[model samples]
Structure formats: structure tokens, C-alpha cells
Target: MKTTLQRIGMILFMTGFVFSVCAQEMEVTGTVYDAHDKSPLVGVTVQVKGTQNGTVTDVNGRYRIKVEKGNTLSFSYIGYLVQEIKVNKLHLDVYLKPDKVALEEVVVVAFGTQKKNAVAGSVMRVADQSYYLPSVIFPYPREVNTEEYEAFKENRFLSTIQHPLSTFSLDVDGASYSNIRRMINQGQMPSKDVVRVEEIVNYFSYDYPQPSDGYPVRIVTETAVCPWNKKHNMVHIGVKAKEIPSETLPVSNFVFLLDVSGSMFSANKLPLVKASMKLLVNNLRPKDQVAIVTYAGAAGEVLPSTSASDKQKIMEALDNLQAGGSTAGGAGIQLAYKIAEKNLVKGGNNRVILCTDGDFNVGVSSLTELESLIESKRKSGVFLTVLGYGMGNYKDNKLQTLAQKGNGNHAYIDNLQEANKVLVNEFGGTMYAVAKDVKLQVEFNPNFVNAYRLIGYESRLLNDEDFNDDTKDAGELGAGHTVTALYEIVPVGVDVPVGNVDKLKYQQTKNDVSLPKFADSKELLTVKLRYKEPDKDVSRKLEVPVLANRMNLNASQDFNFAMAAAMFGQLLRNSDFKGDAEYSDVIRLARKGLGNDPNGYRHEFIRLVEAVEQLEK
Candidate 1:
């Protein structure tokens, strides 16, 4: 981390307002400025929520808009943060702060197939503390083939009696699996960091029943003998997000936040983004509104918010984009969110679809600043979907941070087919939020099991207390999405699962105060889930207790295939708990679970296992 951030600031100059309410409407007026130095900010946009009425701030950082008393007013500016206020009979003044991640004076070369002129402006890079400019100009640069990932250790087995509670956020991200598949297809061995087992397991949907109850997500579980570790018991836990029909889903407000940086000048980057976004655009209902924001040298709104019925306007905006300039992700993010907030949808699905390689080389380019900005903006009720493109030079770490911090999920679009799978086939799940901050906590009964290990989800683990904390952020579940987790349990009487740790010395014994209660409970474990409604702040909780039934010789088809995917993950990562796990066994389990194979995703999983087998050979 740097010692001090260069307090790049923004300011709002406020003049008092009269109760001047005529027919419940008033002329809302305000000015935006640079907070650090009080310099007037030009081109700031002030808009009334849920309406097309808006105006831009002049060079004096002043603007006025007439809106209703209860309407929300959005103040937005490039390279700065956004401020929103509801109209009341009070003083009208807001001091906007700087988006530290604001893009500086960055430049990029715009090259065509034929020779093109070099960019003229000097590109800026950040230095710690006080600033000094030693201008360095270089020619067209060579592409850097590098990628970043979130590093996490595998979950380990814990004694049921010692640590009876297991808690983690339920995640539906499938980026890791498709990303690994891309590497395998290209004959590259996916490193450990590149493999997230939960994502791999969640790449395919299971036939988990939807919520029949009033809740938005339903929890289902099936018990089966562990495929890799035979003596161990495996439990497949599935949480299915309620599916809202296309017509039933709230009208959407979308902002396409695209990265057109120099790094994105590849076949799989900007071009692919345009194509992928078109698929989503075609799926939007006529009532939905779409806007385009692109960031490179500086962030700008390429297309104003237009109704989806005008498909040609939206399509042309995406088609006209060309990749260039240094990454100004901060500016782009703020602008996109600003647009989404300006066109706020009451009880509707509002989202920002960010297409990027996640590389930010210039313009307030610190990850911490970007994260802080995103966390603050999520309160506006707009969801986020991060579509990562390109391979080498990919910043998965940044994508992960932006998505998890916001009400969002991340997906890597390596090819057009994967793009179709995410944006088209699963449009409902990809674009609509059925539930947010969904978390699961499991309590293992000492009487039913000796020890248990949760497969994958190392990054999504929450503190045991977080399950009940409404303020804690968890995973966001989209409409019709299913999040599955597997736990390998060692029944009380069975030999300790392979790679066993020493018996947990909980310090208390059979005569201890807690021991008698463990012996009294007949249930195996209880799965509790907590989630917040899309429009509410309070959380709702649901739980289902499983009895200590014997392990089944036959399991649900979905359970079988999910376990197969889990086994494949263990083998690929060479997990410590992978007892007797082999590629052949993974293939067999996958084959058994290929019930209907609706989308042939199971077949793809089997092929991935074979690819890994060949790699090992």
C-alpha cells in the first residue's frame, strides 16, 4: 500500500433553496466543484430520478433541474464521485468527494491496420506522497501476457465436536471453471490459484427444486457416499434462487461499463465485449433502458440512456467503440453508476455490466481506492456484473474485488460460446437479482459425524456470527440461479477420513457441560441460510435440519454430478483431502450424474477431466 493517497477531491457548491413547492415540484439547483481546491467542475450532470428530465452543469459548476418533492436527484461528474439526495423542504447542498481512482491525463495510441499517428498527450502514473513530473514517452508497446488471481488455501477437515459450526457465503460465479477450460484448451496447465472449486462445481446447473415457500431461495440436500473418499460421507447442499419469469421481472436499467484501454486491443477483448453485450441487449425488454460508458484515456458517456425499444441506437453505440488509452476504471465506474442512479428504477433490476481485462495502469490506479468507491456506490440498489475478457494480462484480482464488494458476480468470457452461455442462455440469472447477501451456516452434530470438511469456497467463508449480521455482505443470488456446496463428513463410527488431523483437543470431555447436549441431538446437521430482499435492508433466515440417516447407495443425479465436479477439482488441485481420487473415478461419477444432460454441460465436465488426465500423463 502507498503511504498516502493524493487526495484527488471533488466538491459540491450548494446554495440555499426555498420551500418553493408548486404542485409538489421545485427547481433543484446545485454546483459541483473540486473539493480539494474548490475549482468549479465543468460538465457535471444533474438528473431527476425515474425521468428523462436532466441538465448539465456549466463551466461555473452550476446546474438546475425541476423535480417533484419526493424524487431523488442524482449529481454526477466525470472523474469524481456521485451524490444523490431526495427532495425535501430543507436546504439543498451536497459536497461531493473525489474518486481517488479518477483517471489522470492518460493517453493511448490509436492504431489501425495501416500506419497511424502516435498519441500526443503525456500519460501519467502514480507516485507515492507529493507529485513530481518527469515526462517519459515511449513508442507503441508490446503486449504483456500476465494474469492475476485471488490466492486461497483449500478448506481443511475439522472435528465435528470441536468446531461444530461451518459458515460461508453461497456463490454462483462460474468464471473459474470456464477460465480453466480455456487454459486447458490452449494446452496450458492451470495453476492452483486459477482453480476455484466452487466456481468449477457451479458452472453447470443442477435440478434443484425451486422455492415453493414464500422465500426466494430454497435449500435442498442429499446424502451420498463420498466418491473420492469411500468411507467418508458426502452431503450435497443446494440453494436455488427463485425464478421470476421474463415478463414478471422488473423493468431493467443497464449501464454498459466497458474498458477500451490499450491492453484491450485484442480479438478476445473489446471485440468480444461488443459481441457479448449485443446478445444481452437483444434480450432486454422494451421497457428497459440501456446506456454506454467507456473508459480509456478518460471516462465518457458514449451513449445516453435509451429505451431498449430503440435497439439500433444501443447497437450502434457498442459497435462504434475502439480500444485505446490508459485504463481509467475509476472514472468509468463512477460514470456508469452515476448513469444507473440517474435513471433509478423503483423496485426494478438496475445493473452495470463492466467489460474489462481488469488492468488499470493509470488514473488513480490503486485497488483500495476503487474498492472504497464501489462499496459506497452499492447502496444505490444497482447490481453489478463483471465480464472479464482476454487471457494473459488479465486482472482477476481486480474483477473479484469490484464484484464482491458490490451487489454483483463475476464471469470470464473467454469465447463467444461462453459469452452466449452467460449473457443469453442464463440472461435471467445473469441480469436479475433474486436475493442479495445470501449466506449459509452449517452446524454438525457430534453424534452423527466425527469430522467434516467443506469443499471449495475458501474465499467466501464468513465468521460464524456473520450469518446473523445483516450488515455483513455475502454472495448475491441472481434469479433462477443455484449455488451448490459439498461437505465430506466422517460419520461418528467410521475410520477418520483420510489425511486426518489429530483428534481436536476441545479440552472438554464426555462429562463436560456441552457433551450431554451433543449426545442428545438426533439430527445430523442443520443448514441455515440468511438473505436480504433486493429492496430491503433487513435479512430473513431459513433453516432445514437433516436427520442422521445412513449414507445412501443411490444419490440424486445432480448430487452425483456435483460430486464428480468436486472430485475433478480435488484432482486438479491435488487437494490434501483427495483420498483415492482418480480421473477415472471422476469420469464415472460424471457419467452417472449426466441425467438428461440438458445443456451438455456434464459432457463438458467429463471432457475437462479427460483433458486433465491427458495433461497429467
Candidate 2:
């Protein structure tokens, strides 16, 4: 009888345990807001404590997630204090305070700001000083200095008579545009160095006709009145890469070279990277493979190359990552390349996706050293995609150099929305390269155009001789990628002083060289493009001549929008060439030319311009 009673008690206990377990697993919903302003915080990360399962706040700052009643939910934003709430109730609202300590401890610098503790001699005491020091203390501003940018000299107008051929590698990176938007939204103007005109102009998608022919790329050219300078005409050159369907794309072998160093401990750095990687992993196909390689003080492969079919396993590995040690970026690069090459898919998309804050402190940290390392790895037929995160002490120059040398594209991820745009919506273009070693050479007709200046390719400018050299490495064009270049041209009859060069008394006044009759007729310039197949070493050349037909600035929405973006960049950089280009003009042109902004990127850009104008006022 006693044994029977004990069995009944055990049965009841087991049933209760099952009920408890089921009760604990419930759906939790919440809204996150700013403590001071009570405003909804968009893109705030809400994750289950000690787990990778998380969801970001929607436009209204509302989030829903399934979690155990006993588990905790962590709410984190870039500049806000992290908040944790016990999941005891079904609905929980969280108000996160701004992290005042971080804001007060930052020191503003010319190029960028640095943390007070990071700056040398920033906290020196009076005891260490030999001379009297005056101390003036003021209330710390809420702003934190987190932006880092490199200053570049603006391109000046070149006389076609002196230099007729303009050569440059194509650029498809769009990081600068997003980064500038972030600054403008924060009610601050981005530093001059952070504004790359080419990146801004190329950020938007253009309606260039795709190559229906056997060629891998198509070139389109148009000319219109320059928006910035009415006296000068703007030449628009667009390159459209052939679009390839995702299913038909070659199998992918991707190595995620993640930086989990101590510097990446911020909410926006390592945590955001993991979130971004999760988005990418979810988008992977069954035929694709991924490997996780991390660097922190030392480099090691955390997850071996695994098929994308096992997404849960990959996500588990990503969730287990924790940031701590110093960065060994160079070692990490070497190991990642080694793994990628080992599992390389022949005739497939092989690439390394580097997610970091660009803070390389340990071995092989210099920009030149990192460039050499990446350049060496590029020869292995593996491309790179650099996704920069965070801001304080960001090595923008270093990251740009590495991406350029690695034959890859670069982007800055400021939020989950950007991650989705880059890793999810544009996955094919971000991963698969349609053509490699793409270079552009424009030969201006000395008769139709007296002088011309190519804008916003200073870093990519190549020597005229380098155009014909097959061994020279240039930029890579991804599937469905569109690249645009703008040239401010001076007509032959325009009387513009071309930098006032001294007349060479030793040479003939005008060489008796015969000029092509078409040069004086309608041919304004010749556009020549050289690109190689993804797997080939030799390049194929395409050439087209642009006529001297000039149209009104309102010729087409594409033309107007392109020129507006270029003018915006010039205004941001305070280029001397930007004559009478006001913020009002930019807003007017951008709003009118915002064609079918399905993704709303163009509309967002227009809003940013308006915001900047308000801030300037």
C-alpha cells in the first residue's frame, strides 16, 4: 500500500513539472523608449539573456519575443544604458537612460574624437607638471566624439590640353553615404574627409540599361548643365553590371573574419556584428558554406567550415562569441584566407566578410602592413567585404586601404536596418562578383572640350599607362552593381583659366598634329572600360564615344539626381569648385528626382538634406 502511494506521488510530481515548463515558455512583448525624452527608440536590440535569440524594436519601438518566464531580457542601444528586465509578466516596457559617463569622457579632436582615457596626457595631474596649470571645468556636453574620417584634397580642374586622358578604377563602396547620414541625423555635419563624392553619387541605384549582349557590363553616358556651376557642363558615365539570379549564382564559400577584441565591447560593435551575422546566416542557401574565424589577442577558427543547411549550428556558434582580448587582425586575416582556400569552391563566390571597428592594435596593425597582407591574399581568388562598426578610434583609412587592396567593397553598418539592406536585400550584389579588375579611361577631345576634371576618385586615380597593363589590379564589380562617375567639362569656346600654366617658350606654340575631324563635330569624349572575367587574368575592353550634346539640368530624373548627389558631396567637403551650390538647391533637385524610391533610401537622403539645412540655419 505504501509503495503504491509513493508511485502516485511521483506521477503527480512529474505532471506538475511538465506544466511548469510549459507555463514558463510564454510570448513577451514590450516597448522601449528614452528615459529623458520618452521617445521611442528604433532598432534597439532586445535579446534573451545569455542567448542569441533576439529581435530588434520596430519603427514604433515595440518588440515581441518568446522567452521563459524566469529568463531575463536585455535591451541595448548604441548610446543608451543597457537595461535588463525579468520576464515575469507578458508585457514589459523599458526606458533606457543615456550613458552619461561615455559622453563626459570623450575628448574632441580635429579629425575625430577620442575617449578621455584613450588620449595621451589627457588626465595628467598637477603633481606631474613642472609649470603652473590652470584648470577650467565645465559641464560635459551630451555629445560623444565617435566619428573618425580621413581628409582628402579635392580634385581640381585639369586642362585637357595638358592631360587628356583621365584614368581611375571603379568604386562601388557606399559606406561614406550612410556614415554621413548618421552624422546629419545627430544634428552635426560630417567632417570633410568623411564625404566621398563618388560614394554619395553611387549609393543610389540608377536605371542604367543592363547588358543584354554577351558582354558582362554596359556603359551609358549623358551630359547636362552642371548644377553646382552653371558655366560648366557635367558628364555622367554609368556602368551597369549584368544581374545574376541568386539560385543560378555559383556556390559560395564565406569566411566570417570577426573582430571580438576588447575595443569591440561596445553595444554597437560586437553585439551588432553578431546580430548582422545572424541576418546573413539566415539568408544563406543550402549549397553555400560558412566558417567563423575570430581574432582577439590571438586568432583562431571557432567554427569549422560547415554547410549552410545547418543554420542552427552556425547561429549557436555566433551566439557564443564574447569580446575581451586585444586585436590580432593580421593573424586573423591569414587564418581566414587559409580556411577559405582550403574549402574553396572552384568557380564559386569565395570571400571573407570582415566585421570590425577597424581598431587593430596587436601584430601587423599598420595600414601599409595590413594592405600588403590583404593584397597577397587577393591573388588567391578570394574577395573581401569589409563591414565597419562602431566609431570611437575607428581606423577608416586602414579599413579603406584593406578593402581597396583586397579587391572588395566596404560598408558601414550603423543599425540593424542597414544590415538587412546589405546582407539580406542586396545579398547577391554584396557577395557575387560579375567582373574584376574594372578600370575606366576617358579621353577628352581636345577640340570639343578644352579642360575637364573627374570628381571624387582621388584614391582610385591610376596612371594612363596603368590602364593597358593586365597585371595591374583594380576594383571588382559585383552582380547588379551600378557605378557612376561625373566629370565637369569646359567647352572649347569657354574661356576658363586652366590653372594659369606658363607658356613653354622652348616648344612650338601649337603643334601641327592633325586632329580627328569628328573631335570638332559632335564627339566630346571617348569612354573606354577594361574588365576581366571573374576567373580570367586578361581583361576585355569596351569603348563608346559621347556626343557633345548638352541638355538642360532637368533633362532626366537620373541625371538631375546624380548631379544633386555630387553637389551634396561637394558642399559637405566645402569644395572650392562648388559655386553657388546652396543646400536649398540640393533639396529641390533631390526631391524632384526621387524616382520610385521603393526602399525609401532616396527619400531618406532628401530628409537628411533638409535636416542639415535646418541645422545650418
Best by lDDT: 2
Candidate 2's residue-wise lDDT over 253-338, tens digit each? 99999999977776567777887898888878999999999999999999999999999999989878888899999999999999
Clashes of each: 3, 1
TM-score of each: 0.75, 0.82
lDDT tens digits by residue: candidate 1, 1-617: 24233232211111112333334677777667777788766545566765535545543566555678888887655346777788885346556677543222222222111111222221111111122211111111234346777778999888876688999988899998888876664334566778889998998998888898698999998898888777788988999998888888889999999999978875457766877787788888899999999999899999999999999999889867888789989889999999999999998889999999999877656779878988998998999999998765788888888888898899998765677789878888999998899999999988788889999999888989999999889889988999999999988788764454454596655436665464587788999999998999999999999878745789988998899899888877878888998999999988989998766778988887886575455
User: Which residue pairs overlap in candidate 1's backbone?
Assistant: 10-35, 11-35, 146-393
RMSD of each: 19.3, 7.9
Per-candidate local distance difference test: 0.78, 0.82
